[model samples]
Target: GEAMDRRRSCGVADAVCDATDASCTEGAPEVVQTTRLYAGAIGQATAHLAETRLSWESQPRNIAIFLRRATKELIEPFEMLRDWLVSRYGVRIFVDPAAAEELVPGEATWTPEQRPHLADMIDLIITMGGDGTLLFVSSLFERSVPPVVAFNFGSLGFLTTWDFGKFRSSLTRIFEDQSHLNLRRRLHVTVVQFDEGDRPSQVSEYQVLNEVVVDRGSSPYMAGIDAYVDSQYCTTVAADGVILSTPTGSTAYSLSAGGPMVHPAVTGVLFTPISPHSLSFRPVVFPDRSVVRLQLPQSARGDAQVTLDGRVGPTLRPGDCVVVSISAFPLPCVAPLSDTHTWLASLATVLHWNDRRKQESLTSASYTETIAAARRAGEAEQAIDGGAREDGAVFDSSPTASESLDDRKTADRRRGTRRDRDKAAADGTVARSPAVARRPRHRRRAAAMEQAPELACAETIDDIESFMRHA
Candidate 1:
């Protein structure tokens, strides 16, 4: 079975005949090889502080390192990785001009302008920060992207799977054997600008991994946006903003705005409103093939800002439209050995999906006991009132009617005094006259809290069943 699985994933076009036939190889096909790599890392001072110790072993090879800026402590890891790669595999290391000046002394560097020329020779990408680093690397490539392996060195690591401890083993597996990959879809967005009495022209274009957000920037009034899907008019949204998200982005800002969570395997886009003025403006999911367009109305109170993957893009004036569709190329993300396990673990640890303190049991016996006690108290009060009325009627024509009335008054006074004493004892206060004694505030609050759940659970099973049927 293992042999068959290997042969199936061997990247060969033709099927293997038999193991003994000599043509069928045992492991991955010879076509797979990674000679040049493009490595990126988060160069923030905080990232270096978070990861105090960095150690790894790798063969020397030619690789490019991408970073914005770095501190002295953070530069050590990049230098270490570079030295390891050069010492083991005799690999030459490349870095951006700024990082090259700081970390890789005497090594050649590539500028931002030379990235397109450098992209052709890169075989794979290794990112050493968080999901943001991966997104930044994705933005660099305009065509086909090299497979990326990311390490979790940041707070939220939805994309970064591997840690520094397993970096060597993970890289060895990828370099030496067949590895599974998750193909993440990206969105292509184009902004169209219009001039007075002139045709609309393409102003800007960007490929985003997460989502495209159109929002009312610094505007106190709600944004007025017209939405369309596949050239058909959808609706005009008046809200704080609207998010158009890819499946990869469904768990990002979209999730915060009450959008549904979509599996990475799904190829659909999400349309979710941000604080919509109307409650009926619900989020909608469209097929990947559908083209979505959003335009700011002429009556809009302010200009709307278009952001791709949380980065600032073109600003949309009134009558300007933004078009979004699936891009031709998909990002090839290197999957951890246990894909589902890692994903589920991240959801629990990072996102805290279902993390909460265990709630006290709602259907406790104390609830029923409290309800029964309240009912008994109410019945006893009714009984006392009835007895008093009977006494009054019986003593109406008696010779000793005045004496009987006096006796009843004495009994009522005694009951009131006893009640006051009980209240004083419960409240840890001195016993006082009936006029001065008051009910403890906590008793009333406790009664209300106890009664609330009882009323909620008062429905019968038959009522629940009927409600379910109607629903």
Candidate 2:
């Protein structure tokens, strides 16, 4: 098994695996405009966002507030922000009912059911939590989501870029329409039911901000599932499950499942298997217009369930399937800037992408000697800047100059090397000789503090599933 472990022909041969998935179909339908968001516990993959600069006319009127929890630590700040928005901008504020069981007196609240009526009424949505908060907001408004400003309060805040400490100033700029926006697209997914006659009925439709997962539930046996691309049978998945991800979800579950890190700006879909049975069955990426379907094989032993984002959905009976495609309505998320660096920034802070320890080249003979040499150089420079050291230490103890060349030639003529040394020895005033010049040290590229982080509270991981349940 160890020798057979390889990435040879990982994904389906015909599967699209473009690193920069920029090309779209010529006949692709026009993309819809809406608010976008990032969601998931560990976060999910994402696609390219439609960039837009906020204008004066685009300023939000009625804003909605969402929180990770309603604890004192979370609610107090919400109150202050709500008061400030109402007094300064005179904007109406609405809150999510889930965030607070009992709303503050006189404060308005909203639910996902009101999205249709409140879509226009709520001009801006502000969420404080991890990326999950943003995804919950996405689930609220299936279509035409208002621009959203997400604050980071979760463990890994890739999607929630802004800091809570600077929320006031950030909101000021946002309200002034000086902020940039990235309109992200979500996966439009539908769970359809099938009867024994092969007739199918739509069970539920959802706009998923992250990846859609279909995996074996609590069953002990590995489930066999069939996959389709553009309605064509592609391959069968024999594993815990399979994932269909949006570009936005590329960072979340898709990444964890060994899928490529498709940029949120690079519009595409990802297919990643979870604990796959076949070694060659690898993750795949498809163009934006591509439609994928995952079905259960009739020979499967048990039922598999679908999980949208991180939330569990309907169960998959033997014949049922899930259809996934690019959503026409893209979510417009408020961004700090309109540049590619934002994606790079997220990778750096969240994933520490490409971060590594730099190697050091020791030009000196030994590490201790190198350290001593550096210390001497620093001391010499300090002595020059100031007066001499308090200890009056000598910089170099070697002779300043060698015996004159003419004198050495005269000595050589008078006597050979040994006799010359004997004459100098007899004279008692030995002629001093110069030492060879030392080679200049190469510039040190690394600092002393540049070291790999030390592990803390290094406990042995007993069991991942049990640990998660307890956590």
lDDT top scorer = 2
Reference-based TM-score, model 1: 0.63
- Lowest-sum lDDT 10-residue window in model 2: 7-16
For each candidate in turn, the TM-score is 0.63, 0.67
* Candidate 2 wrong stretches, greater than 4 Å: 1-49, 56-58, 102-106, 111-113, 361-471
Q: lDDT per residue, candidate 1, 101-180, as tens digits?
A: 87556777766777764444455566667788778877776645656677676668887887767766666666653455
274-378: candidate 2 lDDT, tens digit per residue? 999989988888888899988887888999989998998999998998999977666667778773667789999889999997665666357667687677656
Q: Which has the greatest TM-score?
A: 2
Error of 2 at 55 (Å): 2.2
Where in model 1 is the C-alpha error above 4 Å? Answer: 1-61, 101-107, 356-471
